[model samples]
Target: MKKLIQFYLFIIFSIPCFSQSFSFEWTKQLSSTYFAEYIWEIATDNDGNIYGATDGGGIQTFLDTTFDVATSASSTVLFKINDAGERKWLRHITNSENGSIAVDSNKKVYSGGWFIGSSSLPPYTLTAGAGFGNSSYYTTLDSLGNFTSATKVFSGNSFLNSIAPVICNEAGDVAYIDNREFPSGFTYIQYHTLTKKNSGGTSWTKAFTTTDVVPLYIDPANNLYIKGAYTSAITVGGTTLTNSGGQDIYVAKLDGAGIYKWVKKIGGNHDEWLQSAATDADGNLYISGYFNSDSIDLDGIKLYAELTENNSFVAKINAAGNYEWAINLDSNAYHFAMNLLVDEDGNKVLITGRYTEEMTLGTDILTVTPDQNIYVARLDLSGNILSGMQITFPLSATIYDRKLISPESMLICGTFSGSVAFGDSTYTSAGGDDGFITKINFCELPATYYADIDNDGYGTPDTFTTACNMPIGYTNNSSDCDDSNNAINPLALESCNTIDDNCDGNIDEGLIIATITPASATSFCKGESGILNANTGVGFSYQWKKNGVNISGATSSSYTATKTGNYSVLITIPGSCNDISDETSVTVYNKPNATITNIDATNDLCFDTSIKLKTGNGVGFTFQWYKGATALAGATSNIYFATTSGNYKVKTTNSFGCFKMSTPYTIIKTCKLGESDSPNLQVLIIVLVALKCQQPIQLLKIVNFGNQSL
Candidate 1:
């Protein structure tokens, strides 16, 4: 009987694998004759295209096309496939090891690895400087799998390049970190050489000291993170961190200009290797690996690994190099290679690795039958394991790469032998260990819902939870601005309340209250003007109105009323609210008529004679008399007397508080007593003036010498 992998086995031996919360959709097996080894790395572009880098020997069959490796050594093979598992094209790099692959935002593909001896990559051949060590090689290809640039090789004597881990930014700036081995004193030292090249062909390099380093991710901000294992103390960015016994794991971050941001270390008294890492959209880092130590310290929280067997662990770190949480699986088997990936939305973390014997994942115990030892787990951002499952291969299997695809699916590529079962479908290898790519999906995880307290078909955005079904008092909509009121939602009508009824960040929108200053009628003379002011607001447009019509060029908050009319203003907020102000009646009245006339019409009035001046209209008018420019005392009447005046006028005021001035009436001193004809006559004139003549005295003919009547 064939050996079986038992995941929480009960009494039955033919039971299905530990019930998984996920199911396999499809699996594609790449058959080969001479054993297509590891599927090193896998990447995807925005166009849903999947690219894989692998190593194989001799002839390999990809879809319907067979490709030759030419040499007997393991050569690098890069292939492209669509989202629907359709192979597009493949390239063979002879005599190269398993390489790394990355797809930039521009859909440009990058592939690199270390090659021994003379490796041929199409028209470009890279020859090693020496016949012993390895030299790094890198190349680029367009989205359609066509070569866009010449293959570049890096080789020198001081340092040796091993595996090339490459990445690129949106601006087509390419950067890679290659493992460099060199001799320091009598001992051989290993580190990483980080080379950055921009589109302008400007390039620079930086060195990091470690035992081995792997470049895992480059974020959208061009910040890169590298994970490695170091045995001794290493200084980065002026901070020195000493290893805590055995081989410790270190993660470091560098900006686009190759400046070290920070470096962190995690380890225990025994050995720990960080094998896989991933970054979220927020630049938070997630790493997974195996440790043979009894306990590993992650920033202050410790996880026990049990010295008897190797265990797998996962941890999360913030962008500022702060440890959030860490967790480990209780397993007695040796976890070798592992791959990790965070979902595109950064909600979930997926970890895939190979393990032997038995492993304890959370509350479930999974026991593998002999060689069937593949584990896949899903975890939340808080380091809580959601689900765990195992993929059983009768012979051998190693998952090297895992990616998250569209429509909530996981695409994993690896090498498996014998017959491997993926849910209901099983794939058998053609000869040796064949390369495989499988798409898996979660069954039905709980989804988050918000609370709808007012039953308004909308829910509060802040209060939410995850559940398998819609919880009572909860809904899928999260657009309710006020959950306590049913009328305050995204669909609610705006009113005069000081609140954002439509959840659009505006208060009382579309229900404008137009108001005017004074709020009363303005009274003025016909030729005079009165100012009418309306309410002012930011982003508000105004149009003044005379009665109910829009006044031309009256687009201001204040309007000038020149003529008698009902004045108003249209206040508007463009695309939002508008209103017309209450009518402000403006009464423009004509001035009261005041015409002065001389009653005693004479050619010239004598000095001692008086004249009466009357106004044209005296009813309902108050009059004032003026001599030249001086007002006569006690002249508040409809008529005035002119005794001896050069010019006289009357001012008439009506009940409407409007006053008018009549034209001036002139009077001349035509006749006068002889100044000094006789002293006695002058004395008589003086005596008459002293009497303050109450009545006008008719002047007789001038009598020279004593009072002679004329």
Candidate 2:
């Protein structure tokens, strides 16, 4: 019988198993294209069309597989794309000197630039008017590549060195930096704006001005942030102005109403200009620029802030305009940082720059030999240099401009010394400093996967086969059954056998059972016992446990534990089968305690009061007084009463005890009809009266008993 029972348990524990898998590879490089003149910017539109802004080739458009240059003499070549990576476009301002490009959500391109010529066509005739003020224009383009409107946003006799435009809001309002000449002969940063209605009109409002020369950025809240170099000391908007050196990078934050919130100066004695600034999701500002630290440490670090003459520097500033970290890359004396691109993860920044090396002649004849190699470096968000790699192409001339096309690619536009080999073509320098364009693609390899099957970083030599069965003691990777145990093999179903058929260590581990008991039941109070029995498997040991601990000396088919607690039992067959039944638990709750006591109403009595109220004398007892169904405030003592006639009761509760109430008491207010009651009696009456009055009176007293005096 025991052997038969063991076999029955083995048949109950058997199941199936499965596995998981994966793989990868790389493709060849795609064909590349070349361009005439140096490229300043390469941006990809939503549809994957590549747009290259070249110095001499106007705007080069590579659309739908064709590489062609758009011949527009007025093209300044500023490119930007939408969030979806589609709708590639370039901003061009006619009759203007130099300009910058910005795009809005409506796909409208906003171009702000200086006008150099008087002619309305190509080679816009340059008019030598005021010192630096003849070229300033603003134009907007629609989605279909048509110029919706053009307006001379700002025109002055003073020279406008730089113009930066930004969309301030979704309402089509734009803000830009206008570097107007100050009366002190120093250029100052001025804010200008254009409304939605006057897209073509030459109407603009001068918002604000600062004693600095640089572009300003407008945030989502319509606040303005400006960064640039300042010379003379001038106070603007209550902020004290101070310069670091010849030209130090200065930042100013303004409110929506063009009011200055704070101004910050960063850098040392050397010339430091903030080239670009970006804000993170947390509003922390990141500014990058070239710092020539010759005498002072802008960021306090000699390597990062000190002027190394030729090395370039990048620094990160937090939202409060405080320097967080900084790093210096390379020792090339003529290295210039052009642009910074953040990776998709936003944790790393890619910086692109041009490195130039100078060559020396005889004793006193030192010539500047320019290597003009393109260098790119990846840096952590904290400004720590990661992988700094440079790719130098031997060109006959210098590389004047370059821009990043993608996180892994860049378009280098510069005047090559001679014909240069690009992707699949060669770009020849147009005679005297001809413009050249080339695309550089950097490929990243896939990461390898590793699995530690033996609990080590390395793997072991384990043979895998297609067989469905294997010899005893050997695991067949494909089968979930244990061949070593006849009772646990897949052939067994459910006959109460006891064995690990699935190769697992335990017997009947995965078996299931059902149990039923009285849904609603009761048990005795404290110090009393009750019986709890389960209708389960036979021959079970019935070792009862409570709250996960074994109940000493309590072993029976049913447990009679006196104390209340969670109870469970384990059943063991104790035979060749050695099958252990699953443990089941039941919770036992202790009954509430009960007690009774009486209250002394004599000394605590009120005027005209009768009947007695009481409380329990139980330990940990607390009392509460109720008058006509309403509990009285501060009445939680062992005794309680009222002077007037009304239903009164005393409630008492203790630890492990249920709340109990005393019999209701009745009190009546009465006074002598005629006689001036005895002095002693009157005194007692007055004291009781005060006690009754002390009872917190409800706002609306239902009855007003007649007042009497002795």
How would you encode candidate 1's per-residue C-alpha lDDT over 1-710 as one tens digit per residue?
A: 01111111000011112333454556677777775556767787778788888777767776667877753677878888887777898887777775777787788888888776788776677887763466788888888777666554667663456546676656677777666566778876776777777655777777776455666566667677777677888776676778899988888888877788888888888788776666788889888877888888988988875444578888899989899998886545566436676765548877767777666666666667665566767677888876666655435556666676654455777788888876566777777778877766543464677999999889998898664335557898798888999988998888765689998888876677788884334887767778888888778899888879989999988887878888888888756567888898888878998887667767266643777777766457788889899999998877777777488888888877788888888877745554665456552243244656688778745543555653
TM-scores for all candidates? 0.53, 0.44
lDDT of 2 by residue, 1-710 (tens): 00000000000000111111101011111112332333333333333334333333333442122233334433344444432233355444433333444445565556555555552322233333555545456556655546665555455565343344333333344665554443445644443332222332333333344444343455555555665456656565566667766766677766555556766666566676555555555555555556666543544544443335645666666666567776666543566665555453556666655566431111111123233365556666877665554455545544433444344444444445355555334544433344444444344331223222322222212433222222112332323343323444343443335655444455564443322242333244454456766446666555667777888886666666566566666655535232323344433444323332334434223332544455545567677888878988998876554555666777766554446666766555455232435433322232234345656756632221333432
lDDT of 2 at 502: 44
Provide the lowest-lDDT 10-residue window in model 1: 3-12
Residue pairs clashing in model 1 are 4-369, 5-369
User: Whose lDDT is greatest here?
Assistant: 1
Which consecutive 10 residues in model 2 have the weakest lDDT in total? 1-10
lDDT of 2: 0.46
